[model samples]
Target: MQAVMKNVDCIIEVHDSRIPFSGRNSEFEYTIGGRPKILILNKADLADMSCRKQVVDKLKRDGCSRVLFSDCKHDSTNIIKKILPSIQELIHDAGRYHRAENRDYNVLVCGVPNVGKSSLTNAIRHKYLRAGKATQVGPTAGVTRSVLEKIRVCDEPLTYILDTPGVLAPNVRNVEVGMKLALCATLQDHLVGETIIADYLLYWMNRHRRFEYVEHFGLKEPTDNITELLVPIAIHSNKIQKIRTSEGRYEYKPNISQAARVVMAAFRTGKLGKFMLDDDALDSLSEPAVADNAGDARHRS
Candidate 1:
């Protein structure tokens, strides 16, 4: 990412809207230098809109001056409209240094995995160029393996976006942060285990008192036990499989893995409910010591 920073006119950091305050790589602020930066909180459609203003205000307080909530899956020109003007203004203010003086603008789209970087790239391409998808997009993390060549998104301003692989911090700060990232599918599920991820989701939901999962999964009540939760989900979804026992007899068993996937899918697709996984982190931003940790990691230097 550093190799291409000199060529980048602006940095567009994409993150899951549900985790606006967590899982961000603070190192990017230093890596990208002083180039203008914008935070694209993608998957806004799957986040609780009631806390939208609080999210924006907290981001601004934490020094993210340019933040836009976006849902790249749907054709919403709001993202394009907001981003283009900011890019134009930033580029105009900071004249091109190394490149030939030209109208074309190059933007670097970056974020941790599975936060919709490719989807955002395609959305911009379709909106501005009125063209088809220029990048591959998927629900799994790390879809884009490496830094890709710039793809034209707009013709008038001659804007092109460089889509980079979802780069995570070398070390996650804590378990809660890691679990939140996993819950949002920013990290691959298998790396953290599906059951553990689901357990974290259950704990988070219960802590927030968002018990929509109870009715959604037909559970009598919210229980902390993951096995109890998955059993009913498996039965309801008929996600059962036959396995050979030690006696060499086939036995039908509830597919716990399959059931966990179902629960996660519902959360990811907003079937359960929209949530802000970083809801607790927002309050921490107001504390002086905590607020200091919210900015660029190198800020400590």
Candidate 2:
């Protein structure tokens, strides 16, 4: 990524809007070195849009001024319409430096995994070239293993995008932050147990008073017990397994793993409800940083 940044005109960092204030790779600042950077908080449809302005304002105060909320998968037109103009504006404002004579633009699309980096790349290509998918899009993390060849995404400004694999910080600040990353699907599900993620999701929802999951999943009411939630979900979805009993009879057992996955998928697909998972962190925007961890990165693994 460092080598590629040398030739890149601008950097477009895509991130999960659900956890906008967390999980972004902080190393990029040193790698890109003063080049124009645009933060695209993708998955806007799955995030609580009511807090959109607050999120943008918080990010800008944290030195990320060019933040744009995007739902690349569901609504591409809105972002595609603003992306090029934003890119041009940033590029010109930054004076283009060595690339001033170069009429074409090369943008590096990067972020932690499963945050719609490829989706954004494909969205731009579709809007400009009217073409199909240029890079593979997947729900799992690390789908794009390495930096890919540049592909033209626009004709007017001769814009091209370089799709790169997601890079996560080596360590997270705490367990809850890790859970947030896991819930956002930036980290592999197995790395953090599915049920654990579901529990965290439940805790988060209950903490935020987000009860849409209960109504959507047909639960009687909100509960902290992971099993209590998954048992009903599994039974309703028929996600159960048959086990041979001692007397040769069969017993139906809820597939908790599968049920946990169902819950995770529901949140990812916006079935549970939209969320601004970092709402709590926004409160610290005005507070001074902790002394001991002054340089500690907020980015998650």
Candidate 3:
């Protein structure tokens, strides 16, 4: 990436909008810094759009100048259009000493795993050049094995983008952060366990008073008990698994694991509802002094 950075004109760091702060590769600050960078929060359709202002403000204060919400899966999110103009504006205003003579734009699409880096790339490609998918899109992490060759997304000014493999942070120490990343499908479902992820989803929605899951999942009401949620779903959906006891006798039982996966799949596909996983962090923007004090303490420690 360092070698390719010389020819790259701008950087677009894509992240799951559901978690604007969680699981972001902090190493990007040192590796992809000093260039005109745009923080593209993809999966905007699943995010809390109301917190857009606060998230953008917080990112700008953290040194990122531009932050855009995008939903590559939907046709209405013409965020692809905003991207081209924004890229032109950001590049035109910044110094391009290495490639000053080049008229075409070369962008680098990078971010943590499964945050729609390839989807955004394909969206932009289709938006401008009316082309098909430039790269493979997957639900799990580490799908793109390497930095791909430049894919042309536009022709007017001749824009090309190098889609790189998603880079997760070296240390994800916070359990809550890991859960959020898992819920967003940045990590594989097996990594965090489907039941645990479903439980977290229920807990988050109940805490936030987002009870759309209740109606969607045929629950009588929102409950903290994951077993209570899964048992009914498993029976209704017939998610049963054949289990063999220690005596070697086979019996059919409600497959809560498969039920949990159903819940996860619904949430991922936005069937549960639009969820802003980082609402607590976004709300803190209203109290900068408290955040600054915590920052100070961390720095001091």
Task: Report lDDT per candidate.
Answer: 0.84, 0.85, 0.85
Candidate 2, 18-52: lDDT as tens digits: 88877676766888899999999888888888878
Return the top candidate by TM-score: 3
Candidate 1 — which pairs collide?
A: none
TM-score of each: 0.90, 0.89, 0.91
Clash count per candidate: 0, 0, 0
Clashing pairs in 2: none
Q: Per-residue lDDT of 1-301 in model 1, one digit per residue for the tens?
A: 7887777898888898999978787877889888888899989889887878888998898889888888987745376557777877877777767655656888998888888888888887887777898888888988887557689988887888999887655236899998988899988899999989999999888877899999988888889899999988899889999999999999999999889999899999999889888877765554466445545463453
lDDT of 2 at 34: 93
lDDT of 2 at 114: 84
lDDT of 3: 0.85
Per-residue accuracy of model 3 over 98-198 as CA lDDT, tens digit each: 79999899999888788898989999898888889879898788788866658999998888999988754523659888899899888888988999999
Off by over 4 Å in 3: 168-173, 287-301
By summed lDDT, the worst window of 10 consecutive residues in model 3 runs over 164-173
